[model samples]
Target: MTTYNTADHSDFVRQLYAFAAHIRDPKKNPCPEALEERRMKIYRELFYNNVESFISSSFPVLRQIMMHERWHGMIRDYFANHLSHTPLFPEIPREFLKYLDHERIAQPDDPPFILELAHYEWVELALSISDEKVEIATINPKGDLLDGIPVISPFAWSLSYRFPVHKISPDFQPRAPEATQTNLIVYRDADFAVHFIEINAVTARLLQLISSNDHKSARTLLQQISVELNHVQADVVVRGGMEILSDLRKRQVILGVRV
Candidate 1:
């Protein structure tokens, strides 16, 4: 009887990955010849389509604009080159974001705002599925905005991007930055519905202060903002800050004061 080399078992795994890698990006790596061609082709189609579906759903806008060939090529490149940290299927979009952030380079044909737009889309999906919880019992839902310490909701995220990511589409691609920066808060409410709100620099700064220093009362936050903006009138800033905080609370962006 002929003895099969025991060492071939380890090599088999290496060969299988090599075969799949080639299928992912044939131009970058040659297909393995030892495997049956038809079987390899089946494996290729299944793997690529699985990854492609998730990417397409995650980035629908990005999908609609690109030519099918170019889009497939990019997806193949992602599958071949990127090493994802998570094995969970729902988290693939986040892994793709990491790939775009670190590994993938922007092609000449890709829009300048591709990264920001993808990030915006991912944020919506992320917030929608997030299971993080916050204490509601200790919070005073109708607390005074000026005197109470505002607690930011666990679901609230204050994001600043160079591009107006919410408005980006294939038809309206902007090549340069606008004079004003894009400041947005993406939050999930008590009903578990995610909402987006655009805020000015002053309000964004106030949220930043609240997040960074949870110990500070809303009045103290407003005072710090007054100093930062060099506003001669402190009371005016405090009054304006109250209105902003109250509006945010009504929208469930702020989960009321710590009681």
Candidate 2:
């Protein structure tokens, strides 16, 4: 058996750290002298490529809208910095979002809506892979949305952004934030397909109420919203809320009323 001294073990650990550091950021960290340069080159490329590929897939719309060099540079920054909380590959998108949200320093050329776009794309990926299962039988498919307690699907997410993230693509990247905030409900249907619907502030608030309350009927929630809105004709608000509720049910944002 080969017995290693403490000094030898310390040196080996230092070398490992150096190797990882260099792989994460060759421009800043020096490669370990013990590493073969040719082999290290292959290793570094493989590791960076894998991280870049995962991020690229996770934020396809963000990738599409960004300049190629800028996008890769951002990925390299993420690869070199953000320490992920989980080891799962499926969680990389969430990790990347963390990097974007807290780690990254924005660049002059980067889109104003970059973070929102990345988040929106991440939302779709999250809904597709989420483990939360919805039981259709517990919900009444034909129940009156206004009379019965409206049930927001576990897979449905109500999101609000300063930019129209869903509308972002290579063709239309807004240089500045929109005057009004964009509200969206992204949901996974019975077939497990992720979809998004743009909604107004009232609709967003109604969904928020549904998510927070289990005892309130849709009509009750809408009436509260009308009072909040200070609408002169509360009945008009309720009628509009009913129409939106019916539409949301069809879209799977509201799965149905609870049994």
- TM values, all candidates: 0.90, 0.91
Q: How many clashes does each candidate structure show, in the order listed?
A: 0, 0
TM-score result, candidate 2: 0.91
lDDT of 1 at 247: 89
Q: After TM-score superposition, what is the CA distance of residue 49 in candidate 2 from its true location, in Å?
A: 0.5
Candidate 1, overall lDDT?
A: 0.86
Error of 2 at 68 (Å): 2.0
Count backbone overlaps in model 2: 0
Tens-digit lDDT track for model 2 on 1-259? 1122235568877677778888888888877788889999999999999989988888888888878898888888888878877989899999999888898998877788888888999999999999987787889978999899998888999999999988888899888888999999898997989988888999999989988998989899999998999989889999999999888888878878989
Candidate 2 clashes between residue pairs 3 or more apart in a chain or in different chains: none
lDDT tens readout by residue for model 1, 1-259: 1123245568877776677567767666666878777887787888889999989998999888788999888887788878777879999999988988888877888878888888988998999999997888988888877888888998999999998988877788888878889999999988889999999999999999888875778899899889999999999999999989888989999988888
Residue pairs with colliding backbones in model 1 are: none
| Top model number, TM-score | 2
Candidate 1 clashes: the total is: 0
Worst 10 residues of 1 by lDDT: 1-10
